[model samples]
Structures are given as structure tokens and as C-alpha cells.
Target: MNWEQALGSKAELINTALDLLLPRASAYPSPIHEAMRYSTLAGGKRLRGAFVIAVADILGTDGERVLPAAAALEMIHTYSLIHDDLPAMDDDDYRRGKPTCHKVYGEAVAILAGDALLTLAFCTLSRLQEKGFEPGVVLRVIQEVGKAAGSQGLIGGQAVDLDSEGVKVSKETLEYIHNHKTGALFSASVRCGALLSGAGDEELQALSEYAKGFGLAFQITDDLLDLTGDQELLGKKPGSDLAKNKATFPGILGIGEAIKLAEDQVKKCQLSIARFGPRADFLRGAANYLLTRKR
Candidate 1:
């Protein structure tokens, strides 16, 4: 299958796994459970989760070996989105074309929902060993996910973002935010997939570089979309970064420069994965897709 079709297939698997894993809507403390599903199952591209499947494919790994990690990453991503839209964060009312979690479930439930999703992510990762994976591999995967989503990774990036907001953020500061906020999770996804497949050190290192380049390209285009994309196509308001006083690639470098940077990054990623030949074709295609995606 093409990368898009493979991504869609993996997304379906992730969504199904998420539904089965999460507490039912009728569970005690029903509101939070419902809100968790509402935010998570609602729908998105599932890029991070899809990476697990894609990387596994590249390494000829079994789906059973990597699906758990993929699903866990999606849960973590959803949790981040729920919290990132809260009053204390972006203060937005919309995500993926629906009301924000806080808007629909109220602040208290939204916060709790985010917390629940984050917890569930770790719980999901812990199940890998139960599926007969080597305990050591499972442990490493768990640690990787924890670090990726914790203070030193996504959360830390968010902290830098909040601090840099409304200030004259330097290029280095912007790079820090991009690497930590976006690159960390992307890199983690690749690592999890590679490790699950037992890829050698050289292959892992190459994929690591590919993931970083892809991540930088993704973020740069995200910033550019905020400036040039249609709100409807983007599933949110355009120019929001400017309105929020958040620094972006286009904000630091001109739009032309930003586009050049993104394209260059994509090229670097392609080069990094070139040794894998057709095995990484999907990854190369996926990286390029980021440049033209409307949402």
C-alpha cells in the first residue's frame, strides 16, 4: 500500500485499540471517560501512531510487535492536544473541527480527561510485556515514551513555548521549541518502531536522523500553514500564532526562507533513509506529504 493508505489502515487499528482499552463511557466517573473518548476517538491523522506501523513495515517487523506502542503514542498525543487547548494553554475553542474538550466538557473535566489519557498511554505501553515481548525491550520502550512525553520532551518544549510567547524569541529559542515540542515525539515514534523490530545500531542511527529531519520539516510547514492556509482546511483559525504572539518559523525567517528550510529538511531526511532503498519509500513520501498537507 501507499503511505497514505498504510497510514489510514494503521490509524484504524490505533483507533480500535484505543476504544477497547479506554474505560467505557458508562464507567463510574462517566463524564471524564466520555470526554476522553470524545477528544481521542473524535479523529485526526494519527501521524505519531502511524510512524510505529511504518517503521515496523520498513524493518519487516510483525504488526503484533509494534501495535501496542503505536496505540500508546496516539493516546499520549491526544492527551497533549486536550491540555494544549485548555484555558491555561492555547485557550482555543476548536480542534479537529469540533469544540475543544474544555468547551464541551468544561475545564475541570477537560483537565481530568487529559490526565486520564496520559495515564492510559503508559498503561497501554506496560501491556507490551504481557503480549510476550521481551521484558527488557518493553521496559526500554516504556522509558522512552515516558521521557518523550515528560518534562524533558514534549512538556518541556511546551514550557519553553509558553515562556517565549510574547517575547522576542531568538532563532535558537525557536529551534529549541520546535525540536522539543514536535521533534521529540516524532523521534520517539521512530525509535520505538525501530527498536521493536530489533533494527541494528547503524539502521537506528540513520532512522534517527531521518526522523529529526522529517520533524523539523513538519513543524516548519505547520508554522507556514498558520500563515497561509485556509481556516476550514486547517481545521482551526489561520494566523493564530500571530494572534497568540507565539513565535514561528515564518515569524523568524521570511515565508520564502521558511519554505526553503522545510524543503531542505525533507531532502536531508530522504538522504538519511536512502540506504534503506525501497524499504523506506513510504517514509520519504510521508515526509514530503507534510509540505503539501492542508491540515
Candidate 2:
């Protein structure tokens, strides 16, 4: 599928949508706008947005109909990364190959930038209704996305991750951390696409399974990357995950075992989409890409 090329195209679509949804650069005469722009435009793979758009494509819907929600998901994801790299969290010095927001804009500004991006996410979604999508579907997307990004989902996972750092934890606890911290957003992205496309309950369930598997697989691959990826390749240091004492798949299982686990999850994700036939190709492709990702 030439995943590198495909991923580039997907990333372009996501960036375009984000540009369309961003508040006007001069909307508020504030420095926070620059900070927000710095963080948002620093650039990542935009995998979450790609997943949302791909799911919409699978449902035979146009990307335009789902672009706002997809961009919103990217904004939320970017906000999480911003907060996660704070001095209180990972204390990361660099992100996406550039100095972090706090490093460039100061801590207070960085925090406000994260807050602005987060609130902007909902604002983007709220505008979707004006784009002519079904009102009921838009409402459902908002609700699902809110819950996923809230205390019960990403935030909860982050809490668990913070508490578990440097503490011995069971495999189950590790699962909880990864599922909540990483899986919830994945679940939301897929669910949002399904809801937007009017997918039935059965299809939604299948997509949810696919997302869960992808979530875990994504984290596992990220851990693997931290172990083996070059700083230049990853836009961050290798072995940072272990150096930070972050809980990770490799921390729980040896690297060999972690790779096996990731492979298994990829299979599970592919199986989840089997019933959808050719329409599920992108989902399958995405799962495979996760397994093979170096950065």
C-alpha cells in the first residue's frame, strides 16, 4: 500500500482541515494565539485524524463531511501531548523535532496554549453542525468524544500512568493505563466516524474493537520505537521511555515479548474488520503500519 506515501497524503488532509477550523490568527489579541499556533503547527504524523478520516472513507462518506471532527480529534490529541510534556509530566525538552512550547513560550503560556487547543477542539466540533451533517449524529460524536477525552478516558489513564511511574505494577494495571491513556481517544475517533456515517450498532462495535486493538498496538510500537528508534528518526531521543521510568509494554514484558504482543494485537485489529471486506482495507493497513512503525 506504500504506507509512507499514503500516510503523507493522510497527514496533508488532516493539516488542511485543521487550517480550515482554526480560530482566526487575530481572533483574540493575545500571546496565547502564538503559543497555540506553535504547538499545533509543530507537526506530528496526525495518525488519529487519519484514522478518523479513513473510517469515514470506509463508510463511503466524503472526507469533507468528517473533516471538522477529524481536525478536532487532532487538536485534542495535540493538547494532550502538550500537557504530557510539561515539566511536571515527562519534562520533555523537544517535540516533533522542535523545542517544546514551554521551552519556547514559557510554562504559563504553554499551559494556556494547551487549554486553548482543548477548548478549541469542542469549538471545532460545534461548528460541524453548520457544515450540514445530521444534527443527531453530530451530537453523538460530541458526547462520545467528550467522554473519551474526560476523566473516564484519557485523563484517567494519564493519572494511572503518573501514579504507576517508578512503582511496581501488575500486568493488569499496565493494561489499564494504556487502555485509558491511549485507547480512549482511539475509541472516540473511530466511534465519531461511525456515528457521523450513521453506522449501525453492530458496525460501531466492530470498529470499537479495532480501535482498542490499535490503541494498545500503537502504544506498544511507541515503546519499541523509544528503545530502537534514532533521535533524528523519531524527533526525540531513543531510550527516553525507559530513562523517564515511564510504564511501558517493554517494561512489563521483555522487548521480545512486547513485540509478540504487538503483533498479536495487530492480528486482533485486522480480524475485527474482516467482516467489512474490501472496505476495511485502510483499517487493516493502519494496523499493519502500527506493527511495523519505526518512529
Candidate 3:
């Protein structure tokens, strides 16, 4: 299958796994469950989950062998999105072309929903052992994902980003924020797949490098899109970064320069995976797709 087709197939598989993993919307404590499904089952690129599956594919592992990890990553990503849209955070009204969890389920339930998804992610990760993976490998995957989503990674970047609003930040600070906020999980996703597939140190290192460049390019393009993209295509309101005076690549480097930098990162991403040749085509396509993605 081609890259786009492969991604679509993987996303479908992830959606099915996520649906089965989450509590039913009609179950007890229905509101929270509903909110959890509301945000997660909503459509997304599912790129992080796809990365996990794709890396496993390259290593000759069946995607099903690592399906739990992929699903967990998506749940964690959705949980982050729910919290990011809260009034105390980005305060977004819409995501994935629908009203945000807080807007639909009330702020209290939305918070609980995010919390539920986060904990569920860890619970899901534990299932890898049931799939016959080694205990140590499962533990390592859990640790990697937990650290990426914790105060040292995603949360740290978010905290710094919140603090940097309306303040001029150096390019170094901007890189740190992007690397942690977005790149950390990207790294974890790739690493989890590699670990699950029993990849060698050399393979893992190369994929890690690819993920780093991919994450940075993704964030830069995201920033640029907020400034220049159509609102209808974006699903969420455009110009949110500008509204908050958030430090972004476009804000710091100018639009032309930001675009150039993103292209550079994409090149790095492709080069990092060049050793894998044809097997890395999916990953290379994904990196290039970042530059032109409408949402």
C-alpha cells in the first residue's frame, strides 16, 4: 500500500482498538466516559499511533503485536488535547471540527475525562505483556511513555510555553519548548515500536533521530498554519497563537524563514532514515506530508 493508504488503514485499526479499550459512554459515570469518547473518537491524523505501527512494520513485526502501545499513545495524545483546550490552558472552543470536551460536557467533567484517559493509557500499556512481550520490554515502554508525558517532557514544554506568552524568547528557548512539548512523545512513539519489535541499538538511534526532525518540522508547520491557514480547513480557529502572543517559529523567524526551517527539518528527517531505504518510505512520506498538511 502507498503511504496515505497505509496511514488510513492504521488509523482505522487504532480507532477500533481505542473504542474497545475505553469505557462505554453509557456506563456508570456516563458523563466522563462520554467526554472521553467525545474527544478521542473524534477524527485526527493519528500520526503518532501510525508511527508506532510503521516502525514495527519495518522491523518485521506484525502491527497487532504492538497495537496496545499505539492505542495508548493515541489516548495520551487525546488526553493532552482535552486539557490543552481547557480555560486555564489554550482555551480553544473547537478541536477536530467539534466543540471541545469542556464545552460539551462542562469543565469539571472534561477535567475528569482527561484524567481518565491519561490513567487508561498506562493501563493499556500494561496489556503488552499479555501479548507475550518480555516483562522488561513492557516496563521500558511504559517508562518511556510516562516520562514523555510527564513534567520533564510534554508538561515542561507546556509550562514554558505558557510562561513565554507575550515575551520575546530566544530561538534556543523555542527549540526546547517544541522539542519537549511535541518531540518527546514523537520520540517515545518511535522508541516504543522499536522496543516492541526488538530493534537493535543502531536502528533505534536512527529512528530516534528521524523522530526528532519530524517533530520539529511538524510543530513549525503547525505554527505557520495557524498564521496562514484557512479556518475551515484547520478545524480549530486559526490565529490562536497570535491571539495569545505565543512564541512560535513564524513569530520568531518570520514566515519565509519558518518555512525554510521546516523544509530543512524535513530533509534531516528523511536523511536520518536513509539507511533503511525502501522500508522507510512510509516515514519519509509522513515527514514530507507535514509541510503540506491542511490540519
Candidate 4:
């Protein structure tokens, strides 16, 4: 499949897995469950899940073998988004063209919903052992995902980002926020997929480089979107960073420089995967797409 088609197919699979794994909306204490389903099941690119699936495909790994971890990645990403949109965080009203979880469920329940998702992500990974993945491999997946979502990774980046708001930060600090807050989980997703497929040291190294470059490009583009994206297409108000006085690449570097930085990162990502040839075309296309995406 082409990149777009592959993305859609992977997203469908992820949604199906998420629905099967999560509690029904009608279950006891349904409000939280409903909120979880509302935000997660809402349409998205499912970019993190798709990234995992795509990496697995390059090695001909069974899709089912990676599905559990891929689902976990999606859950983690959704959880982060839900929390990030809370009043204590970015305070967003909408996401993916729909009301955000907190907006529909109230802050208390939304917070609980995000907490549930974060807890569920690890549970989701534990299921990999049931699918015949070795205990050692499953443990590694847990470690990778946990580290990416925890203090040393996503949360740490978010803390730095919070502190950087309304202040002039160095380019290095801005990159740190982008890398940890956004890039860490992305790198984890790619690494998890590669690990599940039993990739060699060489392939893993290349993918690691690719992941780093792609993740940075992803954040840079996201920051740019806050300045240049259409609100309708973005599914939320633009200038959110400006409104919050969040430190962003464009705030630290000019728009032109930020755009150029993303372009450079995309080029490096594509090159890192070049050895995979046509098998890596979708990834190359995906990296390029992130560099130039409008939303």
C-alpha cells in the first residue's frame, strides 16, 4: 500500500484493537470509560500507531505480533493529548475536530480518563507475552514504552516546556522540549516495533537515527502549524502557543529557519532509511509529509 493507504489501514486496525481492549462506554462508572472512548476513538492520523506498524512491515513481521504494542502506543499518545488539553496544561477546547475529553467530561473525569489510559498502556503491552512474544522481548517493550512516557522522556520534556513558557529559552532548550515532549514517544514507537521484529543492531541503529530526525521534524512542523495552519483544518485554534506564550522553534528561530530545520531533519530521516529501499518508501514519504504538513 501507498503511504496514505497504509496509514488508513493501520489506523483502522488500531481503532479495532483499542475498542476490543478498552471497557465499554456503558460499563459501571461509564463516564470515564466514555471519555476515554470519545477522545481515542475520535478520528486521528494515529500517527504513532501507524509508525509502529510501518516499521514492523519493513521486516515482514506479523501485524498481529505488533498490534498489542501498537495499540499501547496509541493509548499513550491519546492519554498525553487528553492531559495536555486540560486547564492545568495547554487548556485546549478541541482536538481532532471534536470537543476535547475534559470539555465533555469535566476536568476531574478527564484527568481520571487520562490516568486510566496511561495505566492501560502498560497493561496493553503485557498482552504481548500472550501472543507468543518472549518474556524478555515483552519486558523490553514495557521498559521502552514506560521510559518514553515517564519522567525521563515525555513528562520531563513537558515540564521543561511548561517552565519555558513566556520566557526566552535557548535553541538547545527549545529542541529539548520538542525532543522530549513529542519526540521521545515517537522514538519509542519505532524502537518497539523494531525490537518486536528482532531487528539487528545495524537496522536498529539506522531506525534510531531515523526516529530522532523524524521526531524533531514532527515537533518543528507542529510549532509551525500554530503560526501558519488553518484553524478549520487543524481541528483546534491556531496560535495556541502564542496565546500561552509557549516557547517554540519559531519563537526561538524565525519561521524560515524553523521550516528549513524541519526540511533538513526530513532529509536525514529519509537517508537513514534509504538502505531499506522500496520497503522503506512509506516511511520516507511519511517523514517528508511531516516536514510539509499543514495540520
Candidate 5:
């Protein structure tokens, strides 16, 4: 199957896995449960979880074994988005074409929702460890994800991004911001997947490079979208990044150059996995999809 078809197929499996892992309808207090489900059930590409499952599949691991880790990845990703949209961060009013959690549920509830999601992610992972994973494997996954989600990775990148607001920054600084803020999680997604499936050192290193290149490409495309995308296509304000004077890839590299850069990055990402055979098709498909995504 082609990239589009492959991604569609993988998405189905990922969604099914998520359904198996999500909290039941009765797991939370009334309105809070509604709010939690509202954000969790809201449509997303489910890319991180898919990455985990795909990599596990590539390494000949069972899908069921990877489900808990995949669910944890999604919870962490959702929590990040929730916090990212808060007033102190991006302050976005719309996400995935609907009112943001804070806008719909009020800030306090939104904060609580984000907190709950974050804790829930760890709880899910801990449960997996309790089931039967080797303590070493669980420790590695937790350390990798914690670093990715914490100050050294996404959070650090966000800090730099916020600090660079309304100011000129060098290209290196901009790249660092994009790499940490977004690339870290992307890298962790692949690493966590590979680790869960027992991939070796060399294969893990290769997938890490693939994830890094793809993550940067993803960010570059997002920057380009912010500059030239329509609000209708983007599902949110298109020019907010530019209006806020944030330094973006296009801001530093020019639109044409930025597109070229993303394409090059995608090519490198694909090259990193050419040896993995048919099992690596999903990774290649995801890279291609990232290049062509409208939102």
C-alpha cells in the first residue's frame, strides 16, 4: 500500500489500541470525566502512539504488549497540548477546529484536566510495568519520556520559544527551539517504541535519526503553515505565530528555502530506515504524510 493507505490502516490499529487502554466512562467524577473524555476523544492524528506500535511491529513484537505504552504516549501528548494552549503559553483559543479546553471549560478546570492527564500517563505506564515488563525496560522508557517531556526537551524548547517572542534570534537558536520543543518527543516516540519491542543498539540509533529528521521537518512545515496557511485549513488562527513575532524557520530561512529544507529532511528520514524492509513502511508513510499534511 501507498503512504496514505498505510497511514490510514495504521491509524485504525492505533485507535483500537487506544480504546483498549483509555479509562472507562465511569472512571472520573461527572463533569470532570466529561471534560477529560472531551479532550481525549477529540480527534487527532494519534501519530506518537502509531509510531510506538509501528516500531514494535517492525521489530516483531505483539501489538497487545505495546498497548499500554502506546496509551501512555498519547496521554502525555494530550497533556502537552492542553498545557500549551493555556494562557501562559500559546494562549490558543481553538484546537482541532473547536474551542480549546480552557475556553470551553474555564481555566481552573482546564488546568486540572491537564494535571489529571499528565498523572494518568504515568499511572498507565506504571500499570504496564506491574503487569510483567522487566524493571529495566520500564525504567528506560520512563527516563526517556520524562526527559523528552521535561526541561531538557519539550519544556526547555517552550521556554526558549517564549523568551524569543518579539525578538530576533539566530538560526541556530531557532533550530534548537524546534528540535527540543517538538523533535524531542518525536525522537522519544520512536525510541520508546523500539525499546518496548527489544530493538538493538544500532537499530535504535537509526530510528532515532529518522525521528529527529522527521520531527524537524514537521516543525518546519508547521512554521510554513503558520505563515501561509488559511484559517479554514489550519483550524485556528493562521498568523498568530507571525503576529506574535515568534522566530520561525520561514522567518529565518525564507518560504522557498524552508520547504526545500523540509523535503530534504524527509528524504534523510526515509533513508535512515531503508534497510528495515516492509515492516518499516509505516515510518516511511508517516514521513511522506508529514510532507503533505494540510493542517
Candidate 6:
């Protein structure tokens, strides 16, 4: 299959796993569950989840063996989005072409929904043991995901991002925000699959480097899209970054320079896994796909 077709298949697999893992909307305390489903089931690229599956595939494991990890990563991603759209956060009204979780469910329910999803992500990770993975491997995956989502990773990056808004920050600071906020989970997603598939330390390290470059490139392209993309294509209004006075690649480095940097990162991402030869073609395609993505 081609890249888009492959990505779509992975997304479908993840969506199916998520549908099974999440509580039904009719379950007790339905509002929060409903809210969680509302944002998550609403469509997006599912890139992080796909990364988990793709890495597992490249490492000679059946992608289905890591479905729980893929689903858990997507859940964590959705939870982050829900929280990121809150009034005190980015204050976004729309995401994935629909009203954001907070707008649809009210702030209280939205907050609880994000919390529930985050908790459920760990719960999902723990189930890997039941799926015949080693307890130690499962535990490592859980810890990796927790650290990525916790104060030292996503949260820390967000704190710095919030603090840096509308300020003249150094490129070093901006890189820190992107690496931690966006790149940490990306790295973890890659690592989870590698850890599950019994990849060697060198292999894991190479994939981590690939993810770092891919994540930065993805963020740069996203920033560019926010500046120049159409709302219909983006699934949300453009220029939200500008409105928030957020630090962005284009903002710091000029549009042409930012594009060049994104291209450089994509090349680095490709080279990082070149040692794997054709086994890693999908990942190289995925990194290239970042540049051309409209949403």
C-alpha cells in the first residue's frame, strides 16, 4: 500500500482498538465518557499511534501485538489536546473540524474527561502483560509513557511554552519547548514498540533519534500550516498561534528558514534509520509525509 493508504489502515486499527478500550457512552457517569469519546473519536491523523505500530513492524513484530500501546498513545494524545484547548490553556474553540471538548462538554466535564483518558492510557498499557508481553516490558512501557506525559516531558514543555509566549525567546528555549512538549511522546511511542519487540539498544537509540527529528519537523510544518493553511483543510481556524502570541518556527526563523529547517530534520529522520535499510522505508515515508500534510 502507498503511504496514505498505509496510514489510513493504521488509523483504522487504532480507532477500532480505542473503541473497544474506552467505556461506552451509556456507562455510568456518561458525560465524562461521552466527552472523552467526543474528542477522541473525532478524527485526526493518528500519527503518534501509527508510530508505535510502525516501529513494531520494522522490528519484526506483528503490529497487532502492540495495539494496546498504540491505543494508549492515541488516548494520551487526545487527552493532551482536550486539556490544551481549555480556557486557561490555548483556549481553542475547534479541533478536528468540531467544537473542542471544553466547548461541547463544559469546562468541568472536559477536565474530568482529560483526566479519565490519561488514567485509562496507563490502564491500557498495563493490559499488555495480559496480552503475553513480559511484565518487565509492560512496566517499562508504562513508565516511559508516564514520564513523557508527566512534569518532565509534555507538561514541562507546556509550562515553558506558556511562559515564553509573546516574549523574545532564544532559539534554544524554543527548541526545548518543541523537543519536550511534542517530541517526548513521539520518542516514547517509538521506544515502546522497540522495547516490546526486543530491539537492541543501538536500534532503539537510532529510532529515538528518528523520532526526535520527525517530531521537530512535524511541529515546524504544523506551525507553517497554522500560518498559511485554510481552516477547512486544517480542521480548525488558522492563525491561532499568532492570536496567542505563541513561539513558532516561522515566528522565530522566518518562513523560508523554517521550511528549510523542517526539510533538514526530515532528512535527518530518514538518515537515522538508514542502517535498517528497506525495513524502515515506511518510517522514512512517514517523515516525508510530514512536510506535505495539510492538517
Clashes of each: 0, 0, 0, 0, 0, 0
User: Against the true structure, what is each candidate's TM-score?
Assistant: 0.98, 0.96, 0.99, 0.98, 0.94, 0.99
Which digits, one per residue and each the tens of the lDDT, describe model 3 over residues 74-114?
99999999999999999999998899999999999999999
**lDDT per residue as tens, model 2, 1-295:** 6666776888898887777666656778567887887788778888788778888888888877788888899999989988998999889988888888899989998898889899999988988788788788788889999999989999999999999888888889888888989999999998888888888889999999999999999988888899888898788778877887888888889899999999999999988999899887778888998877767
Clash pairs detected, candidate 4: none
Rank candidates, lDDT, best first: 3, 6, 4, 1, 2, 5
Per-residue CA lDDT of candidate 4, range 93-125, in tens?
A: 999999999889899999999999999989999
Candidate achieving higher lDDT, 2 or 6: 6
Report the C-alpha displacement of residue 184, candidate 3, in angstroms.
1.0
Model 1, position 9: C-alpha lDDT score: 83
lDDT of 2: 0.87
Give the top-scoring candidate (lDDT): 3
Instruction: Give the total clashing residue pairs for model 1.
Output: 0
lDDT of each: 0.89, 0.87, 0.94, 0.91, 0.84, 0.93
Worst 10-residue lDDT window, candidate 5? 28-37
lDDT per residue, candidate 6, 1-295, as tens digits?
4888899999999999999999999998999889989998999888899989999999899999899999999999999999999999999999999999999989999999999999999999999987799999999999999999998999999999999989989889999999989998999999999999999999999999999998889888989999999899888999999998999989999999999999999999988999999888779889988888888
Specify the poorest-scoring 10-residue window by lDDT in model 3: 1-10
Instruction: State the displacement of the C-alpha of residue 128, model 5, in Å, after optimal TM-score superposition.
Output: 2.5
Q: lDDT tens string, model 1, 1-295?
A: 3778877887898888888988999999899999999999988998898888888888988765677898899888898999999989989888988999999999999999999989888888989887777989989989988998999999999999999889998888998898889998999999999988888999999999998898888999999988888888777888878999998989889899999999999999999999999988778888889888888
Model 2, C-alpha of 150: deviation from truth (Å): 0.8
* C-alpha RMSD in Å of predicted model 6 compared with the true structure: 0.7
